[model samples]
Target: MTTAVDVLVVGAGPTGLTLALQAHDHGARVRIVERRPEAFRPSRALIMHPRTLEVLRPLGVTDALLEQADTAPKATLHLGSRAVEASLADLALPDTAFPHLSLVRQTDVERVLAQALADRGVAVERGTELVAVRDDGYGARAVLRTPKGPEVIRCLFVGGCDGPASTTRACAGIGWHGRPYTEEVVLADLDLSGTPGGSGAQLFAGRRGLLFLFPLGEQATWRLLATRASHGGPGPDFGQPGPPVPRSELQHLLGDAGLDARIERLAWSARVPLQFRLARRFRRGRLFLAGDAAHNYSPATGQGMNAGVQDAVNLGWKLGFAASRPHDSTGGRDAEVLLDSYDGERRPAACRRLFLTHTAFWAEASTGPTPSWLRAAAAARAAPLVPVILQRRRLVAEGVRVISQLRVNYRRSPLSVEETPHLHGAPRPGDRLPDATVGVGGPPQRLHALLARPGVHLLLQRDAAPPPHEVLGPHVTALRVANSPGRGLVAVRPDGHVGFRCGKVDAAGLSGWLSLICATGQPPGRPRPPDDAG
Candidate 1:
């Protein structure tokens, strides 16, 4: 039988699952499909950065993740003969609840999101493969290979969350635009003994490149990620893993980096080809590229998964809000603007992330003579001063924040609108709404907690009234805070970024931003399920 959905998500990985959850949470009738029957892929990413945790907060799955995730793991940097204990846990980032990175496998993240979607009655169609997707004027028609037979699905949008070799991207006529790194990351989840530090993480830096050991606490106790040292060789094949990273090779690499720990028993191992690639375009027609399909980063700083999740969140809500609006309501202009902003906002993020991962990869793993000398110099110099550098609170906090992607903002986005006078260092429109204590007549409550209630929130300060429904339109909730440090009207978007801000409530400005994102005139409280398109 043919099916109809608002968003037809291809690839049921972390990005696709999260995208499905957010779209369903914000209103779209989402159907996520995975080409693979089961999630047998390797969990290459283990650390969930603070910004990613915060972004997943509103999806109602962050708490579950936090319960299972390790947020307080100590880190030790292996600098030749000396080991410097680095603490990202003590960062002075008070604005966010997740100041430190959380140690959890990418598989767990997918499981959590999949369960959340199932709870909302949206089960992933496993073993479902996308055959073709062609635009059909008002929406798109996708052909899928289901167990029963060839099934057709009519969806307002198609989300391509598959990996670098994305079928959806190909179907959209988009090609990968970035290059692959020579070095490949070897992943092994095993138990270790004779380790020098607590059950946390260890980073080894030297001419050979960076090696990471983390207490995964899932599938295995320790997760080791080391970049293979090769002399300007051809990149490993993408998609499927190459071979099992042997135990003896791991031991040799371990001893070379100054770790005395021995692998007790190898639980799982896979070689991930490191690639730095981005899509030619994030969107084409009614299709949108997300996750690894949109951008693939070398396993330099664990950006591929995090960036993909952020991309999903950025595009999901826009899809939900836009799909909720009838095509004739605003002549599809409203939906177009919201959909357009997905590329405008997320494509740049991918570009910036590509630069960051590329730079890190080049310095750490590049095999040229000059690059090797530079690496040796950095490794030799870094070991001595690493201890002293970790002592600086400001520098450490900034570094952590930057790597955590907490400071990522969309100030230049078309959806971002600011009318308030510039208060130096104060929060502005397009910033992720910083968390603060909000008095609700009792002790206190978190601003993020209240904003998590759902929809675009109009937060009023000190008993200020919210704009009427006629002005701001549907799917907007307004709440007055009892005690707020800053007095102004802040419109927090569904994805938790400040969409509109003003010293006072400017109803017109708020409405414009809402309309721009197609947040205005949605189907009342809950977005009505889209009519069957088949």
Candidate 2:
């Protein structure tokens, strides 16, 4: 039988699941399919950065993930006898509600996201594989092979969140252009004898290679990641076939790092050949690519899954806006423009992250004697200054800001419309609106919490009156704030970035921007102004 949906998601991993959930939340009919019959059982992508937590706040899963995850406020690095720790706490990010790194299994994250989708009446169609896709200008049709038989799905758009080997990307003729690293990395989950060094994640660097130990919340349970050289001599080539990493190998690496923890059990292990690749284009016709399908980077910084999730967050609302438009009206053109903006904004961000991860990997993975000696010497020289650096609040804050990805901006995006100079230190168009306490005495509420509602959020300063509802359209929500640093209005996009900012509320400007991005066939509905208490 031939079925139809507004959006057909090609994969059901974290990226695809997030896209499906957000698309459904935005009132789009989304159907997600996974080739795998069941969800992954093993845990991967353990760290959820602060920015990811903030972006996920509106999805209602952040709290659930926090409940199941562990927070690492400090990361300690041990080089010989010298130990330096970098604080991951939010001493720098006072505006954000979540200012620390969250350590949660990827399986748990998928479970939470999948349950949220189930609550919304959408279940992932397992064992449904996309065989082919064809775009005929207006919409796309996908050929899927289900357990029963082959079924055709006609949809307005196709989201390719199918990981590195993306069928959607190949069908769209997008090129995955990059190279893989020469060295291999082995990751394993281990049951340790006791606390390994400290509560937070620990890095042990030496002339051999680098080893990382991350606590998995439970007592004595930890995740270990080490370079091939760190496992004693050049380990098996990950590019070629390899055997399972033995438990003794893990123990030896731990011992080499000065850790005395005994491996009670080797729960799981895998050898991964790192790669840094990005798609040439994110969109082709009615097809869109996101997550690992769009870009793949080294996992050294633990950014692969987080970047993929953020990719979904960035593309989800855009897809929702496009799908909300009527097919017969001029909405098609506006939707195309909105969809095209995805590449402009997300590609650069992915490239930046890829560069950061690659640099970080080589910085710690280089096995050359000269580079290793230099790193060790630097660590030795800086050990005494670690206390002073941690004490200086400004330095620690700056470091946190960079690594947390709070500094990412899309000012170069064509969709970012900025006008008028700001008197207050409010964020500019394309910058993420810093989360802050938004309510009066009755317990502080976060800015993101106010944006739980779908669509573009128009945040009006305390003195500013709400604009006529008809001008903003149904997809736009206006919230009058009691305390705003800026005496103007800021239009926060679905992804939490500022879309439009002005010193005063410009209904005409807002309407123009909305008309371009959120064009629809229906007439403007009645204004649903938020309560004054907001």
Model 1 pairs in collision:
none
Candidate 2 lDDT, 1-534, residue by residue in tens: 476788999999899999998788776899999998988645657788888888877788888888888764567878678777776655756878776767788888998999999999999999999999989886898999999999987998999998888899999999989987765677777787777565478888766568888776223367787875433344443222235687877788788777777887777776666667889999998899998889887777788788888889888888887877776656767777788888888898888888888888787776776657755666667778778877888777666667667888889876688666452567888998888878733666877777866677888887775776667667777787776644588888888888888787776776767766676225446556755663
What TM-score does prediction 1 earn?
A: 0.92
Q: After superposition, how far is residue 269 of candidate 1 from its true place, in Å?
A: 2.6
Each model's total of backbone clashes: 0, 0
Model 1, 85-106: lDDT tens digits are 7666747788887878777878
Candidate 2 contains a number of clashing pairs equal to 0
- Once model 2 is optimally superposed onto the true structure by TM-score, how far is the C-alpha of residue 326 displaced, in angstroms? 2.6
Q: How does model 1 fare in lDDT?
A: 0.77
